[model samples]
Target: MSLLGATALVAVALDQWVKWLCTEHLTEGRPVKVLGGLIYLSLLRNSGAAFSFGSAHTWIFPVVTLIVIGWIAWMATRLRSIPWAVSLGLVLGGAFGNLGDRLFRSPGPFQGHVVDMISLFEPYGQHFAVFNIADSCLTVGVALAVLLELTGRQRDGSKAVKKAT
Candidate 1:
């Protein structure tokens, strides 16, 4: 199988497993300290997009996710190199993780929310928004894609320079 396909499967599995563990162990609004206030697992759910945006338009979120995943899947089949394949795989995995929740999670179908548990920062102030494994994978994948693009790693196919007569 392709690297992207394998990585995507792993990512989806890992994300789902971690989310399940967090939901089963942690209580909402309560922190399970894992480090010296630098990280913790806290169970929470978001009915909206990143950082809890669009909370009021819950239905719209899943629709958008589906569209994004469909586009990504289509793009994945066209990936021409390793970096892009890996990046797309990560995106696909993360997308599927959340998509699963939206499809079969508690509360209702197509209206289900994402479970977020990983957190970092002190409770007093400047804390990052709660996120899940899938979110992290997606963030890392996007960062990798950006780095590849910025460093010109995405253009490795052309012939080397040669002096003209």
Candidate 2:
């Protein structure tokens, strides 16, 4: 539990710090190569769902983000016996990071765009939206969680735990 907690805290802090750097330094739509083009730092503010979808819907994005975060928090409390506590924790942390930005960063409550900096993909073509560390954690965490759920393996590689014990 401590390990998961510590990792979650680290993820949140790292995500926030990088986002701050992005907003402070990078220009919107400009890319700064980090590894000869394999990776770059590009500033982007996404007001919508992942990959910048539903951007025009405005009000809906924040509401859904809030709902998702709320559900994640509730699930966290009920997550005992699941072996993927750390992964779940990461997901929660990442969700909170982006949610925090949406709630308090520029623009307004539930209206602020998430600061994205880390960009990794091929150039000379359409690329994935620029995203931050928190996004990475959320992606990996969700993928892992879903995989576990589908395979019936918890974080410990055991079956879903029985909490009634």
lDDT tens digits, residues 56-91, model 2?
765676676668767766665555544477677778
Q: Report model 2's TM-score to 2 decimal places.
A: 0.80
Pairs in clash, predicted candidate 1: none
Report every candidate's CA lDDT: 0.77, 0.74
Q: Measured by TM-score, how close is model 1 to the native structure?
A: 0.86
Clashes (candidate 1): 0
Candidate 1, superposed: residue stretches over 4 Å from native? 123-126, 155-165
Residue-wise C-alpha lDDT for candidate 1, range 117-163, written one tens digit per residue: 87788542246778888888888888887877766664232333545
- Highest lDDT against the true fold, candidate: 1
The backbone clash count of each candidate, in order, is 0, 3
Worst 10 residues of 1 by lDDT: 154-163
TM-scores of all predicted structures = 0.86, 0.80
Model 2: lDDT to the true structure: 0.74
